[model samples]
Target: MERKKNISMAVIRRLPKYNRYLKELLRTDVDRISSKELGERIGFTASQIRQDLNCFGDFGQQGYGYNVKELLNEINGILGLAKEYKMIIIGAGNIGQAIANYTNFERLAFNLAGIFDVNPKLIGLKIRDVEVKDIDELAGFLKATPIDIGVICVSENSAQTVCDMMVSNGVKGIWNFAPVDLEVPKEIIVENVHLSESLLTLSCLMNDRTYS
Candidate 1:
């Protein structure tokens, strides 16, 4: 049966978990895995896993299950991680530097093209071998170089301004780490990451014994 397209995001979000389980199975030299077995490894119901996979069309046999390597490639293509994404970071503060140094970016097909900062002191500095250029050079740099995404890690006060600059320079997607919400045009995709709220949720989960 064809799955409804309305719940695409929910299915999309589960791909990473499925990929992780598949990777483990591959490491163990498992050639094929039943939906029930895959779900057991990832804490999901077999039916749910089957339904999610059905959204991308059937890949499993009636009783044999799915091919581990084939499923991995399918999920990678679905998540759009099959190709590398060129990205740049705006702001050279701790968060930005951490992102520049993060090894997960390369694993997830995100390449840190460069870093930008408004502070004269931070400008010309190097983080993870990527030089921090002045914010004023954003447009010119973008014009000459190819970057699809931007990571905004500026302070709350300067967040919107920096976002505006990034948008003006033709950044399609933005990973915003600022506390304040930004007002951007409809064409730009902005993803907000609230560190404090995430910590608060983790603290609450840790303190609460009833959370399943």
Candidate 2:
């Protein structure tokens, strides 16, 4: 089924959870599951699941429900995970190095093309076989090798400067971890991962919870 345009961001966000749960079903050798059952496992209402999937396309059958493997493949296609994405990391700090070390990045087809940092100590250090390079070399590296995604893990002060370098060098996607909103061309896509904000969200949820 073809993905429909203008799908709500809320629906788009739920797709990954569906994908993850479907993969788990595959691992368990579950061949098929009704929307009710799948929703039970995922903690969503069956009708909500049906509505979300319908936004993408017509899926499943009247009675037999969804085929686990086939649905997963379809969702993967929708999420643009079928191809490889060449990525570079800037900062090489704790957050940067942790991202570089994560095996799931490669598993998810995000290839770490290079890592860069300004500190002399981190330059030449290797993480997951990719040696850290001087930040000065970023422009040339981006020129030589086309990078699809640029990771910004530098401090807020340095984040915009690093983002500008990446954007000017033809990098289209930015995975920004630095705590600042970046200005980019309309065509450029930026996904921010603010650690502090996420932690605070958890705290807020905890505080808002009422005793049952």
Candidate 3:
């Protein structure tokens, strides 16, 4: 299927939620579902669901709705879950170790290639089968391995340096757990998981009393 360009980030963001919901439906042996049913589950209106889906190619039929498994497969392809990605973590700290320990990423085709750290205590630690190596080895490792994603679990001061090294070594994707926003080239895709910011968002919501 041909993908259209200029798709808004809002729509792109919603695709993951749809992907998750569809996976749940598939696991429960759901065959098909209309937009209204899906919207109700997702708290979106039926028309809103249709509009968001229409950003991609035609998915549901006029009356048949969507074929659950097929829709999921298509969404998976859209989210690049169909391909295998080699990932390396720079910083074997709490966030990095937690990411390494998450087994689901491997199932989603995100294979952890290596882990690096500046601290001597953490340098030799093994999260799973991947041993944490010295941060000094990062440059050579990146040159040797064509990593698809570089995870930045280092501090704000070191995050940009790590990102630069990864970008220079053919790593276009970055999953950053650092608090600071990283500066990268236009081609580089950085997805940040700022823990403090997320918590602050929750705090704001609670104070506002607007959570539904």
TM-score of each: 0.89, 0.97, 0.96
Give the least accurate 10-residue stretch of model 3, judged by summed lDDT: 203-212
TM-score, cand. 2 vs. native? 0.97
Give the candidates in order of TM-score, highest first.
2, 3, 1
Cα lDDT, all candidates: 0.87, 0.94, 0.92
In candidate 1, which residue ranges exceed 4 Å CA deviation? 1-4, 206-212
Q: How many residue pairs clash in each candidate?
A: 0, 0, 0
Estimate, for each residue in 1-212, the C-alpha lDDT of model 3 and write its tens digit: 77888999999999999999999999999999999999999999999998888888889898899999999999999999988999999999888999999999999999999999999999888889899999899899988889999999999999999899899999999998999999998988989899999999999999889655
Order of candidate numbers by lDDT, starting with the best = 2, 3, 1
Question: Worst lDDT window (10 residues) for model 2?
Answer: 203-212
Per residue, candidate 1 scores C-alpha lDDT tens digits across 34-60 of 999888889999999988988878888
Roughly what TM-score does model 3 have, to 2 decimal places?
A: 0.96
After TM-score superposition, the amount by which residue 207's alpha carbon in candidate 1 deviates from its true location, in angstroms, is: 5.0
**137-186 per-residue lDDT for model 2 (tens digits):** 99899999999999999999999999999999999999999999999999
